[model samples]
Target chain A: MRIVEAGKLALESIWANRLRSFLTLLGVIIGIAAIVATAAVIHGLNRYVAEKLSNLGKGVFVVQRFGIITNRQEFLDAARRNKRLLPADARAIAERVPGAEIVGWEVHATADLERGEHVIRDTDIGGVTPAILEIEPYEVAEGRLLLQHEEDHAAAVAFLGHEVAQRLFPNVDPIGKELRIGGARLTVVGTAAQKGSFLGFSQDNYVKIPFSLHQKLYGTLGSVNISVKAREPARLEETIDEVRAVVRARHHLRPGAPDDFGILTAEGINDLWRNLTQTIFRVALFVVGISLVVGGIVIMNIMLVAVVERTREIGVRKAVGASQRDIVQQFLVEAVLLSCLGGAIGIAIAYAAATLLAANTPLPAEFPPWAPPVAFAVCTAIGVFFGIHPARRAAHLDPIEALRSE
Target chain B: MHAAPAPDEVIRTRGLVRSFAMGSATVHALRGVDLVIRRGEYVAIMGPSGSGKSTLMNLIGCLDTPTAGEYWLEGQPIASLGEAELARIRNREIGFVFQTFNLLPRASALRNVELPLVYAQMPPAERRRRATEALQKVGLGDRLDHRPNELSGGQRQRVSIARALVTNPALLLADEPTGNLDSKTSHEIMLLFEALHREGHTIVVVTHERDIAEHAERVVTIRDGAIASDERQPRPVRP
Candidate 1:
């Protein structure tokens, strides 16, 4: 028989047993939905991380006492082995590293801020050099950034993050407003432009002050983080090596010994992100694979039952001159049609779920354009893989025996 | 043993034998039966249960192959043909009507009639037209859209007959065509067969009922896997 006719016959049979067909499709539906939804979440996260990392400046790199510690053991080891990065290290890198176009350093602590009766608790406060603005550029909404002489003379002036400024000075202009940080009053010199939240955490919720004042208030025991900008983006690796050499020489490390510090670049962060997401993607793939196999087995089992139930019908078809190939084609077509229908339903459900997740939750989801076609192809492969045996069994039945069956 | 069938012959069988292995023992369904039926002949094969008449019918319909024999349909050697070739022969040269009107329960009468043509790979429009013509010939032209469950036993049988005739085969083979019908419906079906035979179609009816066998021009009776009598009646019984 022609394939079209066989398809029509399959559709008729499936339609005749609607509830059974739907039950049979459930496993495949769930399998494909899991795959599509997981892929959408991963795709969205990758884009989000890439965009966030790009905000770290084109060729900027950071040197710190502990960089990207993944586990408690690693954090403990780094804490014991690494030395606190001092302001001297930043000055040495600025003087010695020829490829470093700009070098800046910063120190941070959590502090409570108060203006008369209004108070904001546990807000991040940073002490940064004047040159840090050139390395990591922040847009100013009002007033101006600190001058180079402000750091030299330890001026009691602070730059407020957009959220901090809005909260502390709700009705008045934040510029030149005085705010108390741990009993040390500092006037706000400028307010940074609003930077939106990332992964539901507010980006504009910190205060920046001159490095000399922070040293006096928070003390010099804590380690400082050093930021370096390369003269040319293409030569960033060479500039990083130069900075590494300056820091290692200053620490007096031997040739074979590991450096007592960590250097982080944009590419390093991207690689770490990709490594994490790839692991997640692989686990999702494994789970989806199992579900699909289970789904396929269910389909095969049902098709075998259908073959037995319709033995007499098969005999009638064979008696009407349907060849073994024709019988096989008919059953195989039915199996594929059933699986693809499941895949289509799965794609629709995944799309709806992805849209809902993106709309209502902090977790982002982006439905990939190629998901539907690829899902259908996988489902077709599964159908054929599971369908062949039952179709062959139907084809090989003795016509006389089949006809004799009730 | 390799002789060709005559141009006017519809079926020829020689020393046809069929056996089955029922557990450890073998049962011989047909043993050394020879038969011939020419074109335009209305023949009846009659036998009691376990008399091998059904075996002969199955072999003649190309649904089963004999253990040892030479059988031909429309001058083609079919006993040695493979399953696919036998299926093709069944499609092009033989039409079958079962004891139970075996129409697809879900399909309309028209689609049931179009089944053979579908396997024949005929295009849709042509298949539809020819199937309609066949149903009209069976006097079911107005009942084309009715499913088998919606039709009476007689109408269902007529639909089966239309399906059988749609391919315009060399032989119309019916196995107990009226076994499930009332006497009136049986009489009508037998009359329809008579009309078809009058139009020069080769036909075979397998039944144990003497009255049903009497409708044919000739009757062959089987006893214990062999033909006991083969007689040509001067005049076949009418309605």
Candidate 2:
């Protein structure tokens, strides 16, 4: 018989028992739903994180005592003899690396600042050099940034961030006012242009002071962090390598001793975030994939019961001259049809639910182009794999016994 | 001993023994039975219960393989044919009507009759056409859409007979075809069988009822798993 005729017969048999057929398809529907929904949500999260990391300055690289990129280091000791790259080393790289522009180091700490009645406590205090406004991406809004003369005398002047300036001198100008920091008082020189938010924290809240005044006030408590800018995008990797080698040579460390400092670039951070989410996504897919196996088992069980229930029908078909293979194929077709139909429903539900979540929730989802078709194909294959035994049993039935069976 | 017959001999059996394994012991259904039947002959196999008459009917219908036998059906040894080939033979050459009116309960009369032809792999148009003709011949053309549950017992039997005749097989095997019918309906079936026999179609019927067997000219009596008598009344001329 033609394959189409065989399929028609299979459908006829399935229609004969509608309730049983739907119950069998139910198992497959749930299986595909779980996998598709979870993967879409995780995929969205991965995208959102990469977007945040790339929003920082163009080709910016941070060298700190602890990794700001992929790996987490417990210790922060760039002071090791061969690890610490001083301001002298920074200047040498600024002149040596061809496409390198300005390079500067900054030390970070929490500080309490007071002006008359307004006080800001536990605010970020950055100890930056005179070249920070150029090398760092901090733009100037009002007054000029600290000049080279100010750094040589270890100037007591400070640059207020936008939030701090508005808080301290509501109606008055902050560029010429003096504010108490940690203990000593310093004059405000300039305000940084808006940097917006990074990772969830406001970047507009930190205060920048000349490195000499920061050291004069909090020398024993804080460590140093460095930032560099590349004149051209192509020279970034070469610049980073040059910094690494120069820092190591200044510290005079032996080979193979682990470097105490860490370097972070935008691309490096993006990769780290994807790696974390992908692992979680795979684990979720596998956990949900178990449902597919359950669906297949359910089909096998139902087919076997159908074989027993329709023993007489089997006999009637055989008595008329159906081959063993014909009987088997008919039943197998019924099973595959059920699974394919069920799988389509599953993918639809998954997609609809994912779309709903993406629209309403912060974590959005995106389905892969191949997911629906591949899911349907797998469901059909599973049906055939599980439906064969029952079909064979029906085909091989003896006509006499089957005719007699109730 | 058996003598090989020509292809025209519709059914020939010699020393055909069929035994069933009943628990630990065996029950012999047919013991060294020898018989031969020809085309266009209306033969009624009559016997008492436990006389292996049903066993012989099943063997002749190719529904069961024998324990040991030399049963040749239309020059083809049925014992040597595999399961599928036997099924093919049954479809092409044998049509059966059981006493219970064995029709698919859910299907309409037309669809029930079309079943055998469907298995024969006939195209849809031909199978449907032939099924229509067969049901019309049995006088159930108006009841084609009605299921077995909706039809009367006698009408149901007529539909079963229509199913048996649809394929135009070599022999119509009716096992107690009228056993479940009232006398009036039985008489109607007998008239239909008579007409079919006159139309040059062969028929074999198995029944214990003497009155049912009297409708055929040839009657074979089986006893103790073998043929006890073979007798035939003189041929009556058609009107």
Candidate 3:
């Protein structure tokens, strides 16, 4: 028989017994759904980390006492062994590194802020030199950013983040408002524009101040985080090496001694992020692989049952001149059609679920254009792999013996 | 030893023997049965239970092979052909009608009638056209869309007849064609067979009922795997 006619026969049989077909395909549906949902979540998270957390921008890097550490014990050990970066390190790097375009020192701590009767506790207070704005640009929603003169004179001027301003001066113009932070009175110069959250952490609940004023108020409360920008992106590696040599010279370390400071660039952070994403993807693949195997077995079991139940039909078809190849082709087509149908349903469900999650939850989901096609190919392979045995059984039946079966 | 059959012979069997292994014993079902059937003949094979008439029918239908025999259909040696070749012969040269109608229950009457044509790999429009014509010939043109369950016993049988005729085979083989029907339905089916035979189709009916066997132009009665009598009636009972 022609493939098209066999396909029609398969469809008729599936439609004839809808509930049985659905029950038989349940395992496949669930397996494919799991795969699709995992792919969407991983795709979205990769985009999120690349955009928000990598901190890798053109010609940018950080010099801190401790690098980005994930393990708690390792972080504590690094903090104890690494010397605090001194204030003069930033100036020394700017003077010595020819590739350095901008050098800035940054520090941050959680502090209580009070403005009139409104008070927000545990608000992030960031101390940064004016040059830090050039290294990590922040959009100004109102007024202007801190000026170079303000940082040189240690002026008590501050920039409120979007959320901080919303909380401190709900209905008033926040640019000229004065707020008390850590018992130091400071005037709000501008409000940074809203930058949404990343991985559930709010990015807008903070304020920026000149590092000179921060030193006077908090008396060098913590190690400085030095932000450096290169003159050109292509020269970032050389700039990092030049800055490392200057810091090593300033610290008076021996030629072979390891430097006590950490250098963090966008490349390092991206490597770390990629490793994390790869681990997640591997685990997801392993889990979905198990489910796929289980699903294939289920389909095989059900196909065997179908073959037995239709023995008489097979006999009748053989009597009507169906060759063994024709019988095998018909059954295989039925199996493949069943799996592909289940895969299509699974894809539709996963897409709907991803959209719902994107709309209502903090977790992000993104659908890749190639996911459905690849998933369908895998499903068809599974069908062929699991279906061959049952189809062969139907093909090998003796016509007279099969017709005698009740 | 019999001479080889002429070109006009549709079925020729010589010294046909079939046996079965029943535990430690070999039961010989057919022993040296010789038979010849020509084209455009209506023949009935009748026997009591366990007389090997069913075995002969199966061998003649190419559903099973004989142990020691030379059988020829349409001048081709069938006993030596392979499984696929036999299947093709069945597709092109034989039409089968069963007492239970044997239509695919879920398929429409039109689809049921199109089975052999589908095996022949005919295109959709042509297969449908031929199936429609066959159903119309059986006076079931309006019931093309109805499923087997939706048709009466007589109509269902007619659909099976239509399926049998759809391929325009060299032989129309019926096994107890009226076994499941009432007397009136049986007579109606017998009349239909009479009409088909008059149309110059080669037909064979296998039954144990003398009344049903009487409808054919010739009757062959078997006893203990051997033909007891072979008679040619001057006129068919149904005619």
Against the reference, the lDDT scores of all candidates come to 0.93, 0.81, 0.88
Which numbered prediction scores highest in lDDT against the true structure?
Answer: 1
Error of 1 at A396 (Å): 2.5
Quote model 1's TM-score: 0.95
Residue B24's lDDT within candidate 1 is 100
lDDT, residue A368, candidate 2: 61
Measured on C-alpha atoms, candidate 1 has an lDDT of 0.93
Off-target runs (Cα >4 Å) in candidate 1 are B237-239
Q: Lowest-lDDT window of 10 residues in candidate 1 chain B?
A: B230-239
The candidate maximizing DockQ is 1
lDDT of 3: 0.88
Tens digits of per-residue lDDT, candidate 3, A197-250, equal: 876788899989998888887788589999999998898898999999998888
TM-score of chain B of each: 0.98, 0.96, 0.97
Q: What is the C-alpha lDDT profile of model 2 across A86-139, one tens digit per residue?
A: 566667666776656767778878888899888998999888887666665567
Question: Lowest-lDDT window of 10 residues in candidate 2 chain A?
Answer: A73-82
Give the residue spans of candidate 3 off by over 4 A: A53-56, A241-263, B1-5, B226-229, B237-239
DockQ score for candidate 1: 0.79
DockQ, per-model, please? 0.79, 0.46, 0.68
Q: Between 1 and 3, whose TM-score is larger?
A: 1
